[model samples]
Target chain A: MNFTRRFTLAGLLAVLLPVSATVAQVDSLPSWNSGSARQAIVDFVGRVTREGNPDFVPVPERIAVFDNDGTLWCEQPEYFQAAFALDSVKAMAPKHPEWKQQEPFKSFLAGDRTALAEQGEQALLTLVTAAHSGKPTDEFSKSVADWFSTARHPRFNRPYNELVYQPMVELLAYLRVSGFKTFIVSGGGVEFMRVWAEKAYGIPPEQVVGSSGVTQYQLDAAGKPSLLKTAKVQFIDDGPGKPSGINMMIGRRPILAFGNSDGDHQMLQWTMAGSGARFAGLVHHTDEVREYAYDRQSKVGKLDEAWDEARAKGWTIVDMKQDWKTIFREKP
Target chain B: MNFTRRFTLAGLLAVLLPVSATVAQVDSLPSWNSGSARQAIVDFVGRVTREGNPDFVPVPERIAVFDNDGTLWCEQPEYFQAAFALDSVKAMAPKHPEWKQQEPFKSFLAGDRTALAEQGEQALLTLVTAAHSGKPTDEFSKSVADWFSTARHPRFNRPYNELVYQPMVELLAYLRVSGFKTFIVSGGGVEFMRVWAEKAYGIPPEQVVGSSGVTQYQLDAAGKPSLLKTAKVQFIDDGPGKPSGINMMIGRRPILAFGNSDGDHQMLQWTMAGSGARFAGLVHHTDEVREYAYDRQSKVGKLDEAWDEARAKGWTIVDMKQDWKTIFREKP
Candidate 1:
């Protein structure tokens, strides 16, 4: 109480400061409400970093993996990637005249949402593969960057990247500063995510693990080397593919894992199965006003098996509406 | 001359000190003999790291890749991985009497080098898969560790890892200290290199890109997960595969690349193809006494086309006998 009284003048000074506009700006995870969800993360990072503590994890071994689509950002309407794929078909439609008359592409181009949804994920995959295959990697990366620069979410009316949850962004920074290496493990295309991951989440291209397209490297006589992407899928990086992706790319079990859907079930399981103190968390999309509410019934970012398992195992289940002080970084 | 005279007393005291006995202690690449080869490396590093230099590269883009087999450690007589595979076959020989009657295994077990050589790499691969596959990843890593603990190089009579090229090891350390991310891009089994890379070369498992076996992840009824190694081959990571592996695993072009054989030819080419400051060097084995001398004519680590290409492209060619002040980090 004395300390509080002594800081009264300083608190007023803080309020007067322009940059220190909000409580979130003054502390770690300021975007997160002071609840068990936030406390669990703080406690886990603290326990692992506390030297001489029995559960202390070395800096090299402190790996925290995140599921990108729903856990880190909004995955409503469609996976941002699926949206990219849909938009790509529209962009490439001028070049591919046949696509104007094609089944999935036709329905997709007609903006027939119900018909496109009925066409299912396979139809979307076919269109995605057709839209972005057989191009050099640099060209693909350029187009993805171009898309990100202009692409906006219909619901939020904000750039897709700016739609990343404010709390999770703060969480990633907090973890990184605590000596934890953060990685994005997603079902999205690796090439697509590598373009914007660095600027968006402070995660470098090398630290991103995701689904891949079969890419071939060809060196021309003029000494120009191009890594060309093909239509074939290399690794899915979803469902059971998550653990396999972690093994192939990361090569070690992560200490902490977070996700919002069943697609991340294996990754969370693998992280929790490791020996020593571990943290596994699920971001429950419970706020319909702030973000789309979905669970077992959702077609995209389904959260059923993982929701049950997380509860059964005592993993942190964050109710978005309750646990976060803010949702998207965008102002309401 | 005046500075030398001023430091005369200090130089004498440095000579009295064990670690500081060499003038090399006062600088980087001490184990590298002062010559054009050493100068090339030093100059390249200096130019890239110098702020505002025309050839300067950013720290995140300062990627340096090294092939493992002969570039870092001795790979003569046979690759260290080949030796491990042979030893693994013997260790597992008692498990099945059928192996005693198999062609390559029979010849290998009987120490018939001539017959085994005729059987070739394919036969050795068969034996290696039989000896190592179907076990869990952790179990395989444990076996590799166990072997490294006891196995000694036949010629050096020292641990295989101890036979690392001291100059190269120092270079790796120097590069890391210079804010460069160092990676092992090798044709060796990723699993085998991962077990010893950290302790021997300060490289982590995730930084190693190599040939791998198809691994399967399974979760048991008791909620136990196991990453099982299958006999199936995944990626070979040799020759042109090097570039593809780099694209798949690293997702970016390296600025610096080093290798000792034709297998690393594509990796070097790919690195050199990247825009702006880049370096590609080949270590030509020429020290028969301290290490195995090999190039062009050798069956293993053949350096014919790459040697010619390196010479034409102005890539640095390191003559092991002349370039390095120390070979095995072992004193005679």
Candidate 2:
């Protein structure tokens, strides 16, 4: 080998090695010291979680709760739970005569999202009650599974399950690795969300609490058994009810909370009010190109009250356009 | 050092090495080869769990459940739930006038274990109903917490929390490590157990399924919020109820099960019958010296039909006297 050829080959190898190292670094989260906002999350979590630290929480008390809809997922255009109810109303349209002429029901059946949206929270509640109640809990769950298998997000053109933010998915896994028992406290139907939560979030059904209707168990003449759902509303898991549900179901206050709207404000407040270290983050949807983006004044997933409080309370505002490098699952 | 001295030291080190290796190996579970029994459990679980693994259960279909009392924890001398009821009755004696003359309450207040035993399941149910009913779930939890703090097991003279078997604790942790979400399905009062389950079992109260009394949330005078318990019997979490509760609460069949008596037989059978790899183990209380020894005909923690079937069904029989080198938590 000539000396000039050897020198050229060695120089090329040196350049390639540095390039590979930079690529590997890009694949992981950037350095925690990058900014004060990211560092706040890291510092609070680290101090409270470190053994023997003054603010160190016991393992049993290491509960971290998150709002499922717009916190860990994309609830744009419509909330996912609302979407489930809308689809259910459509699917069950043939079975009921009253829904054919019902205002919200007719709008839901006709796939008129604009009309349904105008009907507001009360209409959403009516839709949810009609679809979730008056059937056996198991049967309702089966219907949800069937619907999830076939339904795709209108804008994303992907199944609702695939529309979950990849960044939030990583955050859930990261918290679990750090010994926090993550729970989904949402305003969605409890039985409905529980059906697919374990697989999608790695959180068990029992850990996923939400709005619930009354349920009863009974036996048939041949001794066959089943669970029956009644028209009675047991609890509405939203606003202040989110914290109450957390206290009732988990029996502990959360150390960290993630939310997006005023509905989750109470939960974040309750979490942050705890004495030790805490974290409260709000996701601000600001990107319109890669994802649907609307916040403050949006009818669905409104962010006005929470956005003001996030700034006042010093909560981390995750700018969708800047903070996240990716959104949904990578296309194969 | 001289050659002879050095040789003697090397000889001693060789002898000590094997003993150290043996101790380390014994600290972990024995490397038992997969036999027919173990294979049955593995195969059933694998089939139900594998993605597209034929028996590939969907997320909603991935419901695995379990029983508490004799199944997950040690229940001897009397059911732990019953013990809690008895203690509550005694503590509330000063508040209730009828208890002084009530048959079961009198027996409980007098600390007459024999009298309570003579009354059997019917009398015990009456006692549980009287003590556990008629209060909001939260208030009932406070009562239980107060009782548990001061109550000591009659035999061990230790708090009930300290009486839990160490081996069973490890098994629960191991199963969780293997992707199984455990639940406590028992004939015990739900409100009573749920209060402290998180602290003791690493399972939140929501995951606890047990016998329950009907409760209603209402506003008291001055608009104070309260929950009122009714006399209505909601559900009995025992025998067939165990499987039923699992289906209703978790919406899934467990791939693994553990129990010590006939009350748990149906649960084990249900788990085993699921189409895939399943594991069923029975804890045989054979250690008379370290713990109580009773089986086949004992009034409490009885083992009879389940014991005979366990061997025939190829369930692992955990011999408490032999299998565990240590039973309870090591004293600090």
Report the C-alpha lDDT of model 1 over B200-225, residue by residue, as the tens digit.
88988789888887778898899898
Interface RMSD of 1: 12.4
- State the lDDT of candidate 2 residue by residue for B13-96, as single tens digits: 323333222222322223222344334444554455445456655433444455666555567777777788777777678999
Residue B24 of model 1, lDDT score: 30
How would you class the docking of model 2? incorrect
Q: After superposition, how far is residue A244 of candidate 1 from its true place, in Å?
A: 2.0
Best model per lDDT = 1
Q: What DockQ, between 0 and 1, does each candidate earn?
A: 0.27, 0.15
Specify the CAPRI tier of model 1. Answer: acceptable
Residue runs of model 1 more than 4 Å from their true location after superposition = A1-26, A100-120, B1-25, B101-107, B110-120
Could you tell me which residue pairs clash in candidate 2?
Answer: B41-B278, B43-B277, B44-B276, B44-B277, B45-B276, B45-B277, B63-B252, B63-B253, B64-B254
| TM-score of chain A for the candidates in order shown | 0.89, 0.84
Q: Which candidate is the best by DockQ?
A: 1
Model 2 quality (TM-score): 0.66
At residue B51, give the lDDT of candidate 1.
60
